[model samples]
Target: MKAVYIAKHGGPEVLTYGDRPNPEVAPGEIMLRVRASALNRLDLNLRDGKNYRGALPRVMGCDIAGEVVTISPNAHTDLKVGDRVILDNRTKCGVCESCRMGLDQNCTNGKRLGVDLDGGHAEYVTAPAANAHKFPQTMSFTEAAALPIVAHTAWHCLITQAQIRPWDDVLIQAAGSGVGSMGIQIAKMMGCRVITTAGSDWKLLKAKELGAYEGINYRTTPDLSKRVLELTGGKGVDVVFDCVGADVWEHNLKSLKPGGRLVITGVTSGTKASMDLSLLQGRPLHLMGSGGRSRRTFADMMKMVRQGSLHGVVDRVFPLDSVAEAHKVLESREYFGKLVVES
Candidate 1:
């Protein structure tokens, strides 16, 4: 099978596209003929030597949409060969206490695809059949592949961690990002007033098209907190959804109302930041760092996708062989939504 593998973590130039042995079918697993896989910030980080724990010569991709080629006899899923599906990518021990309690994301033995195992940056990949979700018949493979990682993470951060309520004022940073754009849509669906930031007017306008009520061009207004305060009539937003990390940490803290919450899912920007202790001392605030979602939460997100209530925004599609180019596009941070690769 032809695949892209990283022998050493450094840059896109390290990605090698060549033949790799086909994965064997394991009990309780399904072999998929890869159709499309979407790029995420995680992929960039893995390539750039951050948050990655896997060894070299690893296949790296998470958001996968494919057709079932074979189902292991030991698997109990209702899916069959030729069925179209999306990979969950969150590996968990189903019998673990956390998993039984619907907190699979907290499972003591949980592992993530691409990071912990070979992922979908190839012509073929294997996944636990139980982790595969039926794809919406209405969506193309590229669109289906774009939904899993970003959509689930956004839903988990906003609905699960933030516990957003209708009429709340929400602030989403980096509106053009996959998760950021999805966060804006999810918050809007819950009837919240959304204020999102982007580096360019084009992206800000695109964000509004996706449902954000106000767009802040961070390039023009570096300290977005001041503008956010002005937008909220100086009261600050009820929730600040941030993934940009340190670069906007202070701004995120300041843009929130007293007792408001800040839900963080990723740190795309530099991770370190300096802060004054008195900032939080003056006003009570809640800070939440959310990770992967449980199987139940992913199912809920799928329901929304099927019902057309939530949708992924695909900015471009690249062939699997052009994996390097895909990383370049993601690192450039110019795309307004998800970028996909078709195998």
Candidate 2:
């Protein structure tokens, strides 16, 4: 099998595309012929040795959509050969206390597919039978490949953590990002008025097409909170879903109404920030962090996908051999939604 793997952590140049041994189907697992794989910021962090410190020579893709080819005899699943599916990258230890309690997101011994094990960057990949969810036939493999991480993250953050309401005024940071784009759709689906931000005016236009009620070009409007307040008629938004951390921390705080909620999932901008202690006590704000997502929430998100209410936003597609170039574009942050590589 030919795949992209990193033997030494560095830049995109460290990604080696060459022949590697085909993975064997282990018990409780299924092997699929990978059709498409999507890139995430985690891939860049792992490649540059900033987030992961594991062994080398690991395949580098987490979001996968593929066709089932082989299933271990002991695997308990309803799926069959030739079934098209998207993968849930988080593999949890079923016996863990958190897993046993139906809170698998907090599984103490969880291992991520693309991070802790070989992922779907190759022609074929193996995953736990339970992690494979059959996707609707109407969906394309490229779109399915873009759904898992970003959709799951946004769903978990907005629905499960923040508990967004229909009447709420929501603000989504970084409209051009995968999670940010998904957040806009999810918030709109719940009937919330969404205000989104992007670095460019064109990206904001794309965001508006995805249902963002208003778009703010952060490059021009450095004080994002001021515009957010004006959009909300001076009361500020009821909720804020933020992915860019420290760079927007103060702005996010100021953009929220008293007792409003703010859920943060990523920190692409630097992580350190100073918050006024007085604001927390005076405003009684609800600041929360989006942690690991569970299998249940993944299923909940898929329900929306199956109903055609939610879909993956594909920004660009690259062939398997052009994965290095895909990484370059991901790092440049020049595209909207996901960057996919077809096998």
Measured with C-alpha atoms, the lDDT of residue 326 in candidate 1 is 89
Give Cα distance to truth, residue 34, candidate 1, Å: 0.9
- Estimate the Cα RMSD of every predicted model relative to the unseen true structure: 1.5, 0.6
Q: TM-scores across all candidates?
A: 0.96, 0.99
**For candidate 2, what is the lDDT?**
0.96
Model 2 stretches astray by more than 4 angstroms: none
**Best-matching candidate per TM-score:** 2
Task: Note the Cα lDDT for every prediction shown.
Answer: 0.90, 0.96
How many clashes in each structure?
0, 0
Alpha-carbon runs more than 4 Å astray in model 1? none
Model 1 TM-score, all chains together: 0.96
